[model samples]
Target: MSFFAGNISYNTKLDFKTISNPAAFYLTNLEADLDKNKIVILDNSHAFAFKVPGDIFKTVKLPKDNWLSFSYSLNFRWDRSNTYWHSNFFLYLKRANRFFPVIEPILKKNGVPDDMKYLCVAESGFTHAVSPAGASGFWQFMKGTAENYGLKINEEVDERYHIQKSTEAACRYLKDLYKSYGSWALVAAAYNMGQGGLDKQLKVQKVNNYYDLMLNDETARYVFRILAIKIIFEHPRQYGFNFLPRQLYTRIPVDEIKVDTTITDLAGFALDMGINYKILRIFNPWIRQNQLTVNQDQPVILSVPKEGYREMEKLSGAFEYTLSADTTL
Candidate 1:
């Protein structure tokens, strides 16, 4: 039997048993197993799903490092409810199917851990977003930080929104941060709050590690938020999410088109290439404006979709998980 909490029904199984009148009187003496001939068994399988792992993630392991602590554990417990509800965590689960494939290789190639892919989900929900503080894109780099990492961010182009380039840039940034801090937890915290801020905090607090240092709620909760992503997503079956392979969005495939020349109008440029402006934008989100004023100074590269590939808009409605977001890092 399935159970519904707040209109979201969890995949579950129900068991009903009955015995003959004479056998019913022997219930207290009966065995729990199937050896009894008088007992009726209902073996309907709805699939077992739990909103939260029944053990409350007791078996879910965090990265084994010096950083895992009582405070971080508490933070994990506190932050996990956001994932338990059908709303927040389910959205990440659906999108992870799409974005994880894209970002994982870049992180791995850059020598970052595969587990770090959860950071993207935490950063922007894998949505191209502009934070109120003016951070942008998948990795959520602010203006100066992005430019420092070699992402072009200006009126006509903002490669911070570019998945490939920005992911590579993030890998590089994380690599540098990891070198200095020697801890992924601290690197993540430093990513949220600048390296300078983290340095100052470490000095003031006299704490050498991220777990021991007290920080603003945002930075303090940051690593645990990421851990929460790690737990629910890595074990989606335990977290009560059930979807067919087709229902999950997969990696978007496209052909790369390099543009070094100035294009007065990108719409016309897209049409000449046999796709609409919207499709072009979906492919080349880094192209921020309708017009591209490209010159020898900097070339604008675009990822135009291959012949058979479809944008999310063109895909079957049933296949997509349409939802909203609050993309704050």
Candidate 2:
């Protein structure tokens, strides 16, 4: 392993020509190459010490209820591997800056713990992903669950894609889970596996603590994933993610425009806003189709660029893809 310009790279060549279990071989390949200090490095050069670092609990700001067992020490080493220690983690750090500001206040106001926000990182890394089981959005709320949490999901609109609404719905779910399990760690585990599944395990094992229960691999790693995100993002530079403010995605402001009437053309609406259909959709993702039809007593909610908040009407002509030279916002 060599260090260059704050980046670490692992330079190991393996000829797996004679290996049958190559998948298993690759995961354990680096274990044999650790230095005397037990420093393990991955292809991305993210380095971690396997020999349980000093004051593990304090390093991670672990809750008093959580036990920093030997298993967790090992988990932390794995979490700090290239996957979490390198560019993947760096990108998450950047994206978190964009999404967390919007999520934090809601979580706080809804009486959920701040650490729970890391579940967003574990579920989707602040990106849009569709799970094979049909979970969607940054929160990965299942269709039924999203509906239960007040997120709209239908042929016309999927509020799961709406950042603010989805995060609010996620807060609702987390707070609900917290009511059942007073521990954040337990809540994290239950979030991965359903509440019923987790409750069964708790009863069978006679253990109320998340750290003590035996669980499936995904559920076992769920809280650890949240903890890993919390630790790495808390001290990102220490993990080699020295991202600049400009490198992060911008959290642009938007103004909501209420519409009760049906609109046949989204492109024309975008043109009227001095933008394009793409930009309009990017701002208001819940408007899923080219046309929006409001319910009898419901109004269609649309958010548009809030920058400058200029002239009431007058800014329409031949719509150019580029912004006008003198136009501000």
Candidate 3:
């Protein structure tokens, strides 16, 4: 009796109509209902999961946002062949509540699109801890590029891991890329491949749109992946993800202290602050060394979590104790 139960006859074969029927999309995939309150994951490897609401199938639209839809076709796609292809997007959506709220003010302050916040996911899965061909930080800037964008890269510290500083740097970079390409989609493509590379490809292929260009696999799929993320994130219920507000990542309270001078031992510093060294590193991951040495007076802000989550907040802080270049030396 589900309105969604119909088979689409495509060519010679019948395509099971998961998307065509709204009621079927909701009822048949009983396990995927948005209100289920279960942490369902698109992939086991990427550590991406969402807590579904118990009554998601019964509900039509997201609670507050009407701009978002419940249409299955617009909402979900089967990417069983490639998982990470959507991890960049899924992880971003799961973490949007925490990191995104913080990113909005920064983007607004710098005059960028609210949508551009997804660039972090496109760049490095909102993980300040990442290493891809020497790119670092959530924005995924190389050492040279990070320096060009006014981020300090050094042994004692790398500001690329600093969310605010790195986001500011990303805003500047994105704005410039926008000025050059004049399209946000193209600008996103250019982020993966350099502007010069994009220019060469465009000229060679005689195509300006991101989808048309023949380029490296990573760059080719980049824009689509972002779009996919946007679609899934904007319509989680449609894609079979459901979650209550409390189930998603929440903002943590923190206290910031400025250290203009270097500390001989970060471990000792944490003890003095009445917290463990492990906790210290959790908040200020840019701290690469056990001791911070300030050769020439430079100030760095350290964020210490209020309590109870640093040891347990594994997913919230994306990268912990991952290898990264120390530009401070």
Candidate 4:
């Protein structure tokens, strides 16, 4: 009998009575075992499709002294099995299709490793989520840190919610962290727990390696969580996430409108642009309030749909623009 999947053809000679489930047999034969190490490349970048063995830490860019133990494997298994985590992971994957194009170029321009994009996934699930600790946006920069990285934050405009600017800031921040620690793993740890805290732990425990250091629960699981996410994202079908190309979220084309002056009434401005206020905010989440106050020295660029107001109308059905500015529609 011959069974075909993708580009591979399987020829098997076995009696049907020999197996309890022919479907299970074929599936078992078709999929590579998760225990085995195999190399998979995407966009010319190397990644392991399966778990990394103890012997080959360098393949995944782990430090030379690194060891892959049961703890790391357990974390990977835990995420793979957790339904809640899978749900979020699926959403993150879909959102990545929309956001990665905007983010990856900035990372490449800054010479940061492309894999660092997964850290953004671990941080915010590719959404502008505000953490309980007040860390906000895709890269999850706090108010002070966001400002320090050149992201403007105020009542009117918080550039932390701006995808391009925040990603650029993240590249700068990641490069700085890498310079300080000289290890991408340690840079990720510092990003999660703050450099000061990671530095304190390194000094107290007298360890330079992230894997070897004893740290807080969140910090300890941090890198492993990122790794688990990376593995699942790389091998989605193996982990049971199946999606057609059409099912994935896509980026919407936009036209940039530069405004050097303050808009006292954003709703009126949206009406002028032939889009609703809600649609305006949907594309430009960095605009915090109903009104955007722009400085002449620093112009704010807003994105409207490239297909014009019709695209915006498609996103949000036609509604009466008669609501008061303070109505909060």
RMSD of each: 11.0, 12.6, 10.9, 11.0
lDDT score for residue 229 of model 1: 69
The best-first sequence of candidates by lDDT reads: 4, 1, 2, 3
Question: How well does candidate 4 match the true structure, expressed as C-alpha RMSD?
Answer: 11.0
Q: Each candidate: how many clashes?
A: 2, 1, 14, 0
**Per-prediction TM-score to the true structure, in the order listed:** 0.75, 0.74, 0.69, 0.77
Per-residue alpha-carbon lDDT of candidate 1 for residues 100-218, written as tens digits (9 for 90 to 100) = 76777888888998877878878888777778898888889999999999988767778887888999999999999999999888999999999999999999999888777889988
lDDT of 2: 0.66
Candidate 2's error at 159, in angstroms? 0.6
Name the runs in model 3 displaced over 4 angstroms.
1-91, 295-297, 307-329
User: Candidates 1 and 4: which is better by lDDT?
Assistant: 4
Q: Order the numbered candidates by TM-score, best leading.
A: 4, 1, 2, 3
List the global CA lDDT of all models.
Answer: 0.67, 0.66, 0.63, 0.71
C-alpha-based local distance difference test score of model 4: 0.71
Q: Give the higher-TM-score candidate: 2 or 4.
A: 4
For model 3, where is the 10-residue window of minimal lDDT? 1-10
